[model samples]
Target: MKWVRSKICGITRIEDGLCAAHMGADAIGLVFYEKSPRYVGLDQARSIVQAMPAFVSIVGLFVNAQAAQIKQTFDYVGLDLIQYHGDETASFCEALALPYIRALRMQPDVDIAQVAKTYVNARGILLDSYVPGLPGGTGEVFNWSLIPSLDKPLILAGGLSSTNIAQAVAQVQPWAVDVSGGVEQAKGIKSAEKITDFMQALRANR
Candidate 1:
């Protein structure tokens, strides 16, 4: 099957959320960690999720947050999925009993297939660049060639732009693709033009 998926993370405003949905995003990620520049408060996250059109999934992103904190955010925003970017254990992730995606920091010499197997119950695997001091949205791409035969759904991320997404799709053929800094006017701010361009490019590839 043809792989076609897109994610817009770090939404700070309702309009940005709307743009992502209107532009045909499969998922919209909301950051709950205060340390993240793109973090949105409970109220802001709720409003944004509510404003989003139907069929667009709401994904809550956390970086090394506790279960209590994750539950609190979920209760407030009612996210459909969880994206764990930090060193969250399998027990911690399964405790939520909700669908989730685990982010893998792609590094040279790492056994990519073996790493994915550890999160066997995950809804999908998110492959991102291993940038020091950056949780995600670093606008960096790992070598696409390093994907070592995936069995579960794979969501390709990091440094993807409209210009190169087709190349990414052609090569990795992931179940989905995610972009944040690549489609932003600035950190936490999305660009309508960029969103449209990205979607158009995505369609062109298909």
Candidate 2:
């Protein structure tokens, strides 16, 4: 039997945070990138984190933000982990000294194996779809066939929802699956029904 963990990303409201945690999400993500439609302010992020029940991991997502900014967020939000979604170097990520995951956009020229080697300290490697101007949450699926066996845990994101989660999990068998827009009623706002449906689909598949 396989166990596929689920993460509900881009949680903004306290209700949404509680909903995701109550829906059996192993983790919940908060976007700190200002440009993202799903971005959460520091106060909002802190309140969401405070409202969450125990055992649900909180992940703080950032783009190519200044080190001071990330440090401030880490301190203020009390995140359990950090996720680097921009072109942060392995050394820079390591310097933060927080347990972190690296979001890798599956672009044509990306060397997955080499990247895995470069950030060997990442707790997991998240694979997201690549759009020319977007970092993540593009709501587009990448070619699962392009994925190769990796030495580290592989987390699949991008375009995941109740509609396709079962098939996606059956095919890739990732360490986890992350969803944002797919489970939202709008950007940064989560839909309770959609979240329940998505988790049910994933659990049934596993």
Compose the digit string of candidate 1's lDDT tens values, residues 1-206: 48498888889999998998988888999998798889999999999998988899999999999888888788889899999998887787887777889998897778978877877689999999998888787788889887878778999999998989989999999899988888889888999999899988998887
- lDDT per prediction? 0.88, 0.92
TM-scores, in order shown?
A: 0.96, 0.98
Model 2 per-residue lDDT tens digits across residues 146-191: 9978888999999999999988998898999999999999888889
- Model 1, global lDDT: 0.88
Q: What's the TM for model 2?
A: 0.98
Candidate 2 backbone collisions, by pair: none
- Model 2: lDDT to the true structure: 0.92
Off by over 4 Å in 1: 1-3
RMSD values, in order shown? 1.2, 0.8
Model 2 stretches astray by more than 4 angstroms:
none
